[model samples]
Target: NDYGKLGRAGEAIAHSLVSSSAAGRVAYVEPFAPAPGEAQLGARNDRGLLVFSGCGTPPTGQHEVARGVVQVAELNNPVLLNFGVSEVNWWLHYEFAPVCSRTVLVAYDKLAEWDMMAPRKPVLEQVRAQLLASSDTVVGLSEGSIDDVPDASYVGHGVDRHWHDPAIDSLPEPADLAAIPRPRAVYVGALSMRFDVEAVRDLADSGLDVVLVGMAPHPALVELAERHPRIHLIGERPPEQAAAYLLHSDVGIVPHTDEPFTYSMEPHKAYNYAAAGLPTVTLNTAHAPALGPFLNATRDRKEFVDGVRTALAGGRLSPDQVAQARSLSWNRVAEAILRAA
Candidate 1:
């Protein structure tokens, strides 16, 4: 299947990297099956890269994906095999080793250091060691250290700046957004354990209409929405549609619970909010200082409520602030990777 059909961080990177690649310079291979009938292999030119898709359903194992990747890799004779961490599924990427002249790993997050991910650390550590031995370079998010590998590069996650902009103000408002009373305070990422439910409730109690634009599988959050008329759980949206929600909203927020894992993140949502010209207010964290001046880091629930009011008053980001965010585009990130390779 094509990455474009999905809506996740990995899909975002795949789109950016492929869009940045020169015509016919990159190829993507994945394990996929359109039906239950037979093991099928097919290739097509998508965007700029040749995509080899469809292996089989209930995929037998990693070897099946590896075999297809090897065939495509040999044909393309790629200079670098760029690997992004996808948790346990990374084992599949490991199988495609030695296919390219060099290997590079994009450390999307520091799962090994996260307490919740402790159970998988042993296997991840083993993979880390193997990756270190084989990788020519390791690029990681700036919020966390990448000392596991020598001389690893630390950089922030990138956004497709054009996709989120003040110009979206001229576009039609999203149907679901029309009835949500403003001044709207929006949060546009996962509603996971890291999310601060208390903080959101405080904002709603303070009279700000709170909008959450991601999956709300967590039962607590669902109940909170049921109790708070001001709080709206609008469900998950694709990149483009999600950006519109940010652009139309009064302010963007990251109400993450004060935790080590929360401190370890440099959220792509903040970057997206900045690109959309919203004043982003986030819960204070260790990485807050490094996130630049455009983001307002509030220390407590009271501060968070105040931060939203302050953001609503100040309005969207200034021209210079927008430019700063725009400069950090995925095109530049892809260029850096290509140059490093």
Candidate 2:
């Protein structure tokens, strides 16, 4: 249940904010159950603040803006500090962060606008000025959100090294899903419209066992499953156990429909698959370039299938390549992030 998805981002903030409390300063680390809702929430007195979200590009709509702003208003907690919140998720965060604090907080931009491809600089700037005029103390990964509040220890982003090890490079496949004679490939995560559902269907019929390892897709995907037995649609699995399947698979797939966020957003599964040293075949997306050197990419169906085929036929990576992937440990990322944050 305690996956490492937000370890890097969450740890960064915790590292910064926890010690700032007075000796009597009450401290709390509220990592939510399903989605670690709210940024950092803690208080020593009646006055407190909420760090909700950052709006990127053209910034999210006005309703979203008001929603995030109102979250604190409802909780009577307004200290707002924006930290790399996706514009899409801002409203939800807005509704959530205010549960504890309402005092005006702080904002920083240096780390706020990081996705390089963002388009709403002007909008974010406007919101920044609006927020700054009202915050108490802004101390974190932004350029100039806080005027008087000196940058303090980080409160967000870092690695969970305990989960990182060369051992990930050799995760064994699960027998429950691999007992059949099928050669398997894995795709985990949302199976919504944007994923390469059609392409997966095609590959499923090509006589390879294509095992999807995420929540079930729309009803259509199931219909496709009925037609293609090779397309073994095994539902989602626990993170720890499914990781073994990732390692044993002939190849991994990130066949996205090639959208912006899907491309721009860094998919941890790719990093995890890399850690397993399983050659990954992906659709052309923004993250592909960053991870391409370590991956094989194709936008064409034939080429994609062939890439998966070649990677499988080539057998496992040499010991050195596996070691190289292992070197990019989540723990190392965690340490660097903690120091930087």
- TM-score: which candidate is best? 1
lDDT of each: 0.69, 0.51
Q: List runs of model 2 lying over 4 Å from the truth.
A: 1-83, 87-172, 288-292, 335-341
Give the Cα error of residue 221 in candidate 2, in Å.
1.3
Per residue, candidate 1 scores C-alpha lDDT tens digits across 162-272 of 554656556677999989998898888778668888989988998889999887547889999998999999998877778778878889898887765556556667877
157-187: candidate 2 lDDT, tens digit per residue: 1222323554654566577676745467888
Residue 246 Cα positional deviation in candidate 2, in Å, after optimal superposition: 1.5
RMSD of 1: 3.8
10 residues in a row with least lDDT, candidate 2? 22-31
Mark the 10 consecutive residues where model 1 has the least summed lDDT: 80-89
Clash pairs, model 1 backbone: none
